[model samples]
Target: MGWNPFRRAPLLHVANDVGSGPVVVFIHGIASSSITWTNVIPLLAPGHRCITIDLLGFGGSPAPLDAQYTLPEHVAALARTIRSLRLREPFVLVGHSMGGLIAPRYAARHPGGCGGSCS
Candidate 1:
Protein backbone atom coordinates (compact mmCIF):
# COMPACT_ATOMS: atom_id res chain seq x y z
CA MET A 1 0.00 0.00 0.00
CA GLY A 2 1.59 3.18 -1.17
CA TRP A 3 0.62 6.43 0.49
CA ASN A 4 1.45 10.02 -0.36
CA PRO A 5 2.70 11.80 2.70
CA PHE A 6 3.21 15.03 0.78
CA ARG A 7 -0.41 16.14 1.08
CA ARG A 8 -0.86 14.69 4.55
CA ALA A 9 -1.04 16.46 7.86
CA PRO A 10 2.32 17.26 9.35
CA LEU A 11 1.38 15.28 12.44
CA LEU A 12 -0.31 12.50 10.63
CA HIS A 13 -1.34 9.84 13.09
CA VAL A 14 -2.01 6.29 12.02
CA ALA A 15 -3.75 3.19 13.23
CA ASN A 16 -3.21 -0.27 11.86
CA ASP A 17 -6.40 -2.31 12.06
CA VAL A 18 -6.59 -6.04 11.52
CA GLY A 19 -8.43 -9.26 12.34
CA SER A 20 -12.03 -9.57 13.39
CA GLY A 21 -13.47 -10.51 16.76
CA PRO A 22 -13.83 -8.75 20.12
CA VAL A 23 -11.99 -5.46 19.73
CA VAL A 24 -8.68 -4.84 21.48
CA VAL A 25 -6.94 -1.52 20.89
CA PHE A 26 -3.28 -1.03 21.63
CA ILE A 27 -1.60 2.31 22.18
CA HIS A 28 2.17 2.29 22.35
CA GLY A 29 4.54 4.43 24.38
CA ILE A 30 6.08 7.67 23.13
CA ALA A 31 9.06 5.71 21.92
CA SER A 32 7.17 3.00 20.07
CA SER A 33 4.89 2.32 17.14
CA SER A 34 2.15 -0.17 16.26
CA ILE A 35 4.99 -2.54 15.53
CA THR A 36 5.29 -2.94 19.25
CA TRP A 37 2.39 -5.38 19.07
CA THR A 38 3.79 -7.48 16.24
CA ASN A 39 4.64 -10.36 18.55
CA VAL A 40 1.51 -10.21 20.69
CA ILE A 41 -1.01 -9.59 17.89
CA PRO A 42 -0.61 -12.96 16.22
CA LEU A 43 -1.42 -14.69 19.46
CA LEU A 44 -4.55 -12.67 20.02
CA ALA A 45 -5.64 -11.87 16.45
CA PRO A 46 -7.64 -15.05 16.04
CA GLY A 47 -9.89 -13.95 18.86
CA HIS A 48 -9.66 -10.20 18.73
CA ARG A 49 -9.84 -7.24 16.40
CA CYS A 50 -6.54 -5.50 16.93
CA ILE A 51 -6.22 -1.77 16.30
CA THR A 52 -2.96 -0.15 17.22
CA ILE A 53 -2.52 3.61 17.13
CA ASP A 54 0.52 5.77 16.45
CA LEU A 55 0.29 8.78 18.65
CA LEU A 56 1.57 12.23 17.73
CA GLY A 57 5.36 12.58 17.67
CA PHE A 58 5.84 8.85 17.41
CA GLY A 59 5.75 5.82 15.18
CA GLY A 60 4.18 6.15 11.72
CA SER A 61 2.56 9.32 13.02
CA PRO A 62 4.21 12.65 12.55
CA ALA A 63 6.09 14.62 15.13
CA PRO A 64 5.84 18.18 13.95
CA LEU A 65 8.60 20.14 15.63
CA ASP A 66 6.03 22.82 16.35
CA ALA A 67 3.47 20.51 17.84
CA GLN A 68 2.97 20.48 21.56
CA TYR A 69 2.88 16.91 22.77
CA THR A 70 0.62 17.30 25.73
CA LEU A 71 -1.17 14.42 27.41
CA PRO A 72 -4.55 16.06 26.93
CA GLU A 73 -3.85 16.69 23.25
CA HIS A 74 -2.78 13.14 22.72
CA VAL A 75 -5.86 11.91 24.50
CA ALA A 76 -8.06 14.16 22.40
CA ALA A 77 -6.53 12.88 19.19
CA LEU A 78 -7.08 9.32 20.43
CA ALA A 79 -10.65 10.09 21.35
CA ARG A 80 -11.25 11.54 17.88
CA THR A 81 -9.83 8.47 16.21
CA ILE A 82 -11.88 6.13 18.36
CA ARG A 83 -15.02 8.06 17.64
CA SER A 84 -14.23 8.10 13.96
CA LEU A 85 -13.81 4.34 14.03
CA ARG A 86 -17.37 4.29 15.37
CA LEU A 87 -16.75 1.07 17.22
CA ARG A 88 -20.23 0.24 18.55
CA GLU A 89 -19.11 -2.55 20.80
CA PRO A 90 -17.05 -1.37 23.72
CA PHE A 91 -13.37 -2.16 23.36
CA VAL A 92 -10.55 -3.25 25.61
CA LEU A 93 -7.70 -0.71 25.58
CA VAL A 94 -4.15 -1.72 26.35
CA GLY A 95 -1.45 0.93 26.49
CA HIS A 96 2.23 0.74 27.36
CA SER A 97 4.37 3.24 29.32
CA MET A 98 3.29 6.77 28.45
CA GLY A 99 0.52 5.14 26.52
CA GLY A 100 -0.27 3.25 29.74
CA LEU A 101 -0.66 6.53 31.52
CA ILE A 102 -3.02 7.85 28.83
CA ALA A 103 -5.27 4.79 28.84
CA PRO A 104 -6.73 5.16 32.32
CA ARG A 105 -7.45 8.83 31.84
CA TYR A 106 -9.07 8.14 28.48
CA ALA A 107 -11.16 5.30 29.88
CA ALA A 108 -12.35 7.54 32.68
CA ARG A 109 -13.32 10.36 30.33
CA HIS A 110 -15.01 8.06 27.86
CA PRO A 111 -16.54 5.63 30.28
CA GLY A 112 -19.19 4.61 27.78
CA GLY A 113 -16.62 3.77 25.15
CA CYS A 114 -13.85 1.69 26.67
CA GLY A 115 -15.22 -1.51 28.17
CA GLY A 116 -12.07 -2.19 30.16
CA SER A 117 -8.34 -1.65 30.39
CA CYS A 118 -5.30 -3.91 30.54
CA SER A 119 -2.23 -1.76 31.07
Candidate 2:
Protein backbone atom coordinates (compact mmCIF):
# COMPACT_ATOMS: atom_id res chain seq x y z
CA MET A 1 0.00 0.00 0.00
CA GLY A 2 1.14 3.49 -0.78
CA TRP A 3 1.24 6.25 1.74
CA ASN A 4 -1.58 8.71 1.41
CA PRO A 5 -0.75 12.30 2.07
CA PHE A 6 -4.28 13.00 3.14
CA ARG A 7 -4.50 10.09 5.56
CA ARG A 8 -4.59 11.16 9.17
CA ALA A 9 -1.83 9.97 11.43
CA PRO A 10 -2.68 7.24 13.92
CA LEU A 11 -2.95 8.03 17.63
CA LEU A 12 -2.57 6.02 20.78
CA HIS A 13 -5.71 5.38 22.82
CA VAL A 14 -6.25 6.78 26.30
CA ALA A 15 -8.25 3.97 27.83
CA ASN A 16 -9.16 5.88 30.93
CA ASP A 17 -8.56 9.20 32.65
CA VAL A 18 -10.21 9.30 36.01
CA GLY A 19 -10.07 11.58 39.05
CA SER A 20 -8.50 15.01 39.35
CA GLY A 21 -5.43 15.93 41.32
CA PRO A 22 -1.75 15.26 40.84
CA VAL A 23 -1.24 13.32 37.58
CA VAL A 24 -0.35 9.66 37.49
CA VAL A 25 0.19 8.05 34.10
CA PHE A 26 -0.11 4.28 33.89
CA ILE A 27 1.42 2.11 31.19
CA HIS A 28 0.48 -1.56 30.86
CA GLY A 29 2.73 -4.50 30.21
CA ILE A 30 3.18 -6.49 26.99
CA ALA A 31 0.00 -8.09 25.66
CA SER A 32 -1.89 -6.02 28.15
CA SER A 33 -4.06 -2.93 28.03
CA SER A 34 -5.07 -0.09 30.32
CA ILE A 35 -7.37 -2.56 32.04
CA THR A 36 -4.37 -3.63 33.99
CA TRP A 37 -4.92 -0.70 36.30
CA THR A 38 -8.65 -1.15 36.70
CA ASN A 39 -8.51 -2.03 40.36
CA VAL A 40 -5.61 0.25 41.16
CA ILE A 41 -7.07 3.34 39.55
CA PRO A 42 -10.15 3.28 41.74
CA LEU A 43 -7.90 3.29 44.75
CA LEU A 44 -5.81 6.26 43.60
CA ALA A 45 -8.39 8.19 41.62
CA PRO A 46 -9.60 10.03 44.69
CA GLY A 47 -6.17 11.48 45.32
CA HIS A 48 -4.60 11.47 41.88
CA ARG A 49 -5.57 11.97 38.29
CA CYS A 50 -5.20 8.49 36.86
CA ILE A 51 -4.45 8.33 33.17
CA THR A 52 -4.26 4.89 31.67
CA ILE A 53 -3.11 4.29 28.11
CA ASP A 54 -3.45 1.46 25.62
CA LEU A 55 -0.08 1.28 23.96
CA LEU A 56 0.29 1.29 20.18
CA GLY A 57 -1.32 -1.77 18.60
CA PHE A 58 -2.99 -2.67 21.84
CA GLY A 59 -6.46 -2.05 23.19
CA GLY A 60 -8.16 0.88 21.48
CA SER A 61 -4.95 2.30 19.97
CA PRO A 62 -4.15 1.89 16.32
CA ALA A 63 -1.73 -0.56 14.78
CA PRO A 64 -0.56 0.93 11.52
CA LEU A 65 0.45 -1.50 8.85
CA ASP A 66 3.70 0.35 8.39
CA ALA A 67 4.52 0.37 12.06
CA GLN A 68 7.38 -1.76 13.30
CA TYR A 69 6.20 -1.64 16.91
CA THR A 70 9.75 -1.16 18.12
CA LEU A 71 10.65 0.35 21.45
CA PRO A 72 11.32 3.70 19.84
CA GLU A 73 8.06 3.54 17.95
CA HIS A 74 6.14 2.81 21.13
CA VAL A 75 7.91 5.62 22.95
CA ALA A 76 7.27 8.03 20.10
CA ALA A 77 3.56 7.22 20.11
CA LEU A 78 3.54 7.64 23.89
CA ALA A 79 5.32 10.97 23.60
CA ARG A 80 2.77 12.27 21.14
CA THR A 81 -0.07 11.25 23.44
CA ILE A 82 1.55 12.85 26.46
CA ARG A 83 2.17 16.06 24.55
CA SER A 84 -1.45 16.23 23.48
CA LEU A 85 -2.57 16.26 27.09
CA ARG A 86 -0.85 19.66 27.53
CA LEU A 87 -0.08 18.91 31.12
CA ARG A 88 0.93 21.73 33.43
CA GLU A 89 3.19 19.59 35.60
CA PRO A 90 5.38 16.58 35.13
CA PHE A 91 3.34 13.38 35.66
CA VAL A 92 4.19 10.47 37.89
CA LEU A 93 4.77 7.51 35.52
CA VAL A 94 3.94 3.97 36.56
CA GLY A 95 4.26 0.79 34.50
CA HIS A 96 4.05 -2.98 34.72
CA SER A 97 6.36 -5.46 32.91
CA MET A 98 7.03 -4.15 29.38
CA GLY A 99 5.57 -0.86 30.43
CA GLY A 100 8.21 -1.00 33.12
CA LEU A 101 10.76 -0.98 30.33
CA ILE A 102 9.13 1.93 28.54
CA ALA A 103 8.70 4.24 31.52
CA PRO A 104 12.39 4.74 32.14
CA ARG A 105 13.24 5.21 28.48
CA TYR A 106 10.59 7.88 28.23
CA ALA A 107 11.96 9.60 31.33
CA ALA A 108 15.51 9.40 30.02
CA ARG A 109 14.57 10.89 26.66
CA HIS A 110 12.37 13.60 28.06
CA PRO A 111 13.85 14.75 31.30
CA GLY A 112 11.39 16.50 33.62
CA GLY A 113 8.51 15.07 31.65
CA CYS A 114 7.96 12.65 34.55
CA GLY A 115 8.14 13.79 38.16
CA GLY A 116 8.58 10.21 39.39
CA SER A 117 8.05 6.57 38.35
CA CYS A 118 7.20 3.06 39.57
CA SER A 119 7.10 -0.34 37.90
Candidate 3:
Protein backbone atom coordinates (compact mmCIF):
# COMPACT_ATOMS: atom_id res chain seq x y z
CA MET A 1 0.00 0.00 0.00
CA GLY A 2 1.08 3.57 -0.67
CA TRP A 3 1.56 6.23 1.95
CA ASN A 4 -1.98 7.49 2.24
CA PRO A 5 -1.98 11.18 2.85
CA PHE A 6 -5.63 11.03 3.82
CA ARG A 7 -4.96 8.59 6.62
CA ARG A 8 -4.41 11.12 9.31
CA ALA A 9 -3.49 10.38 12.91
CA PRO A 10 -6.16 10.53 15.57
CA LEU A 11 -6.51 13.55 17.81
CA LEU A 12 -4.54 13.98 21.03
CA HIS A 13 -4.91 11.40 23.74
CA VAL A 14 -7.17 12.06 26.73
CA ALA A 15 -5.46 10.92 29.89
CA ASN A 16 -8.19 11.42 32.43
CA ASP A 17 -11.90 12.17 32.58
CA VAL A 18 -13.55 12.49 35.95
CA GLY A 19 -16.44 14.15 37.77
CA SER A 20 -19.53 15.70 36.22
CA GLY A 21 -20.32 19.38 35.97
CA PRO A 22 -18.82 22.31 34.10
CA VAL A 23 -15.76 21.20 32.12
CA VAL A 24 -12.12 21.93 32.78
CA VAL A 25 -9.39 20.79 30.40
CA PHE A 26 -5.78 20.62 31.49
CA ILE A 27 -2.79 20.77 29.18
CA HIS A 28 0.70 19.77 30.24
CA GLY A 29 3.95 21.57 29.42
CA ILE A 30 6.72 20.55 27.04
CA ALA A 31 8.67 17.54 28.27
CA SER A 32 5.59 16.61 30.24
CA SER A 33 2.42 14.60 29.97
CA SER A 34 -1.06 14.53 31.45
CA ILE A 35 0.32 12.82 34.51
CA THR A 36 1.60 16.18 35.67
CA TRP A 37 -1.92 17.10 36.75
CA THR A 38 -2.39 14.04 38.91
CA ASN A 39 -2.72 15.87 42.21
CA VAL A 40 -4.58 18.84 40.79
CA ILE A 41 -7.43 17.11 39.02
CA PRO A 42 -8.84 15.72 42.24
CA LEU A 43 -9.40 19.13 43.78
CA LEU A 44 -11.39 20.31 40.75
CA ALA A 45 -13.15 17.08 39.97
CA PRO A 46 -15.59 17.46 42.83
CA GLY A 47 -17.34 20.42 41.28
CA HIS A 48 -16.33 20.17 37.63
CA ARG A 49 -15.58 17.71 34.95
CA CYS A 50 -11.81 17.38 34.89
CA ILE A 51 -9.98 16.31 31.78
CA THR A 52 -6.29 16.05 30.99
CA ILE A 53 -4.68 15.40 27.64
CA ASP A 54 -1.26 14.71 26.21
CA LEU A 55 -0.30 17.23 23.57
CA LEU A 56 0.64 15.96 20.14
CA GLY A 57 4.05 14.24 20.16
CA PHE A 58 3.80 13.88 23.94
CA GLY A 59 2.43 11.24 26.23
CA GLY A 60 -0.10 8.98 24.51
CA SER A 61 -0.71 11.22 21.48
CA PRO A 62 0.71 10.30 18.11
CA ALA A 63 3.90 11.91 16.83
CA PRO A 64 3.69 11.92 13.11
CA LEU A 65 6.98 12.35 11.25
CA ASP A 66 5.48 15.01 8.99
CA ALA A 67 4.34 17.09 11.93
CA GLN A 68 6.21 20.30 12.58
CA TYR A 69 4.80 20.56 16.12
CA THR A 70 4.11 24.24 15.67
CA LEU A 71 1.69 26.30 17.69
CA PRO A 72 -0.94 26.09 14.96
CA GLU A 73 -0.56 22.34 14.70
CA HIS A 74 -0.92 21.89 18.44
CA VAL A 75 -3.94 24.16 18.60
CA ALA A 76 -5.51 22.41 15.64
CA ALA A 77 -5.10 19.00 17.21
CA LEU A 78 -6.45 20.26 20.53
CA ALA A 79 -9.48 21.82 18.88
CA ARG A 80 -10.25 18.59 17.07
CA THR A 81 -9.98 16.59 20.26
CA ILE A 82 -12.19 19.01 22.20
CA ARG A 83 -14.72 18.99 19.39
CA SER A 84 -14.78 15.22 19.52
CA LEU A 85 -15.85 15.38 23.16
CA ARG A 86 -19.13 17.03 22.12
CA LEU A 87 -19.09 19.28 25.17
CA ARG A 88 -22.48 20.89 25.75
CA GLU A 89 -21.07 24.11 27.18
CA PRO A 90 -17.93 26.19 27.07
CA PHE A 91 -15.11 24.92 29.23
CA VAL A 92 -12.14 26.23 31.20
CA LEU A 93 -8.60 25.63 29.89
CA VAL A 94 -5.49 25.35 32.05
CA GLY A 95 -1.88 24.91 30.94
CA HIS A 96 1.62 24.70 32.36
CA SER A 97 4.79 26.01 30.71
CA MET A 98 4.64 25.31 26.94
CA GLY A 99 1.10 24.15 27.51
CA GLY A 100 0.55 27.58 29.03
CA LEU A 101 1.50 29.00 25.66
CA ILE A 102 -0.82 26.72 23.73
CA ALA A 103 -3.84 27.25 26.01
CA PRO A 104 -4.30 30.91 25.27
CA ARG A 105 -3.75 30.50 21.55
CA TYR A 106 -6.34 27.77 21.47
CA ALA A 107 -8.77 29.89 23.44
CA ALA A 108 -8.20 32.79 21.06
CA ARG A 109 -8.67 30.73 17.93
CA HIS A 110 -11.76 28.96 19.17
CA PRO A 111 -13.50 31.73 21.10
CA GLY A 112 -16.51 30.39 22.99
CA GLY A 113 -15.07 26.94 22.67
CA CYS A 114 -13.15 27.94 25.76
CA GLY A 115 -14.91 30.15 28.28
CA GLY A 116 -11.78 30.90 30.27
CA SER A 117 -8.18 29.83 30.72
CA CYS A 118 -5.26 29.83 33.15
CA SER A 119 -1.63 29.42 32.15
Runs in model 3 with CA error above 4 Å? 1-9, 114-119
lDDT of 2 at 65: 85
lDDT tens digits, residues 1-119, model 3? Answer: 32233455359999999999989999999999999999999899999999999998999999887777888778878887887777878888999999999999988888877422212
Best by lDDT: 3
Of 1 and 3, the candidate ranking higher by TM-score: 3
Ranking by lDDT: 3, 2, 1
lDDT of each: 0.75, 0.83, 0.85
Off by over 4 Å in 1: 1-12, 114-119
Provide the TM-score for each candidate, comma-separated: 0.80, 0.86, 0.86
Worst 10 residues of 3 by lDDT: 1-10
lDDT, residue 57, candidate 3: 94
Q: Report the lDDT tens digits of candidate 1 across residue range 55-118.
A: 8777777666555677766776677667767787888999999999889988988888652222
For candidate 2, the 10 contiguous residues with the lowest summed lDDT are 1-10
Where does candidate 3 clash, by residue pair?
none
